[model samples]
Target: MGHWLDRNIVEPGKLPLLLALAAFVLTFLVTRVITRLIRAGRGPFGNIRPGGLHVHHVVPGIVLMVIGGFGSVAVRGHGPGAVVAAVLFGCGAGLVLDEFALVLHLDDVYWTEQGRKSVEIVVLTAALVGLVLAGFAPFGVNELTPDELQSRSIVVTNTLINFLVALFALAKGKPRIALIGAVVPLVALVGAVRLARPGSPWARRFYRHRPRARRKARVRAYRHDARWAAVRNRLHDLVAGAPDR
Candidate 1:
């Protein structure tokens, strides 16, 4: 285990990334537990208010994130400084994402149905970062051969192709596919060739003139949503506690 860590993570200068991911996930779990307990009125945990102003944890999270970001940039990546910076950044990210709905709506929406977005975003972020730590490079760059890496033209061409495919997937309202495709070109190719969602912009522009295509898209979208909504809700509830009512 130690050999694996040193060889794969620490030696490749990815210790900070692993640390940040661990801290981020842990912080989120801890924060959720406390918040859930507070909501149940079964713990000593309570909201913070100072000078009649409710102080959200996201404030300190932002401060820590800035400090960690700048500190990492300023310090050498050789030693514990990187780890400290990673921890701070992770903690900050956790706190801020815990209330992501608030940031998006510019109001407190925690415990509401809208708050489910926070869990979803956090899960997405964690999964992406975990993929990176597992040796998946962004935009499938890691798939390039050593010789290909030396050819700027080849690199640029590959990147542009992959980006376009991923864009197409996104336009088709396949966000999950697009996200994964950003790391795996094959995923993008598959998504690019698939049908668009019914209400997606792509369907509006291209399928509007084709009733058969529009109907197919709509049916597919409905079936997909019906199949996944319950699972998605349960996952959100498990991660961030179910929405109140």
Candidate 2:
């Protein structure tokens, strides 16, 4: 850990929250700049107003940056590595947002084989995984010491990189790209599971919340089905009563 991530430099508890805020601000600024550049490149003097499609593409990126910024705060306790984690998380968030925005804007031009769909799919998967890890960070590994930085960084970085690579494959029309991209997070998630196992803090929180989540989902499904059942029955009856030649 150098100057940017010195645990000794910042108090453990207060720093994470602050760092999370910083991550958010960083993400916001970076995205705004990127959007501006793209817009400028497409027009003269950048004077032309952006259309709904342009705004649509940028909105998700902005939103994810904001989310990851908060997530950075959550993981601030992980020490120096937290900053690295924050940057990576922010990029992943932005990338995912960019994809969904692009998808909505996709039409004949975007749907074409050479239109970079793979990139969007890869980025979206990475963002989703990053979001998951952001929550898990508090329960995952503690800060990486300077000596351990290289190894741990590799694991985290490779996981993220592989996710992006999978998306690239998807753009090329590869069938298993999404699945492969998903595997990076799955592996890390398993590791997180191991770390949080049984007596660990992460495990305790995860298990405690898991059942509540399931119950809520079940309740929602029951309500939705019950509400729609009568409508479905009416349609069936109407169809059944129709005269046939």
Candidate 3:
């Protein structure tokens, strides 16, 4: 176990990444708790307004992200500098993503149903980053042996194949599958072969001419969504507070 950690994480200089992931997730959770308190009118927190203009958290988030990103690039990947940059970036990301729906809709919808999107996205981002910190590599290339990695042709071929499979999964309207496929190609292949989302580009182009298949796909989607909607909503509320309406 020690050797595995040493080879996969320490040697690859991924400690900063793990730290960033932790900070990102923790920041998001803390931010949500504060916001939830504010929404309930129970906290010392209040809305920030200057000159009758509301100041959103995303502004500071953007600044931090820029500084951290540029600073990291300017400094070496290892050591204290990298760690600091990663922490800053993660903090900024949590702030920005917590208000993602506000940016997307160009409105103050923090307690509305639209705000749930921010929670969903934040959860997804945290999950993906957590996976990375667990030693999964992007594009399934980490599975290559030293000999295969040393061969330019083999590495290139493997990467191209994984990229294509991921793309195919995306084209099928399976974003979650495609994302996982970037780390595990087998998942992508399965997603690519499955039925496309009824509203996806793939279904619009391919299922348009196949009525029975489209109907079945639609039914399946509806059932799945119905089954998970309650659980999803509870999770969103638990993390970001219940919607205003």
Give RMSD to native, each candidate: 1.1, 16.9, 1.9
Candidates in order, TM-scores: namely: 0.96, 0.25, 0.92
Residue range 3-106, candidate 3, lDDT tens digits:
98788778989877877887888888998898877777996998788998888888988888898888789887768999999999998999999999999999
Which has the higher lDDT value, candidate number 1 or candidate number 3? Answer: 1
Tens-digit lDDT track of model 1 for 98-127: 889889999889999998888887888898
> In terms of lDDT, which candidate is strongest?
1
Lowest lDDT 10-mer window, candidate 1? 71-80
Which scores better on lDDT, 2 or 3? 3
Model 2, residue 82: distance off in Å is 2.3
Pairs of colliding residues, candidate 2: 16-76, 20-73, 118-171, 122-167
Candidate 2 segments whose C-alpha is farther than 4 A from its true place: 1-14, 42-77, 98-100, 103-245
Error of 3 at 94 (Å): 0.5
lDDT of 1: 0.89
Question: Which pairs, if any, clash in model 1?
Answer: none
- For each candidate in the order shown, give its overall lDDT on alpha carbons: 0.89, 0.45, 0.86
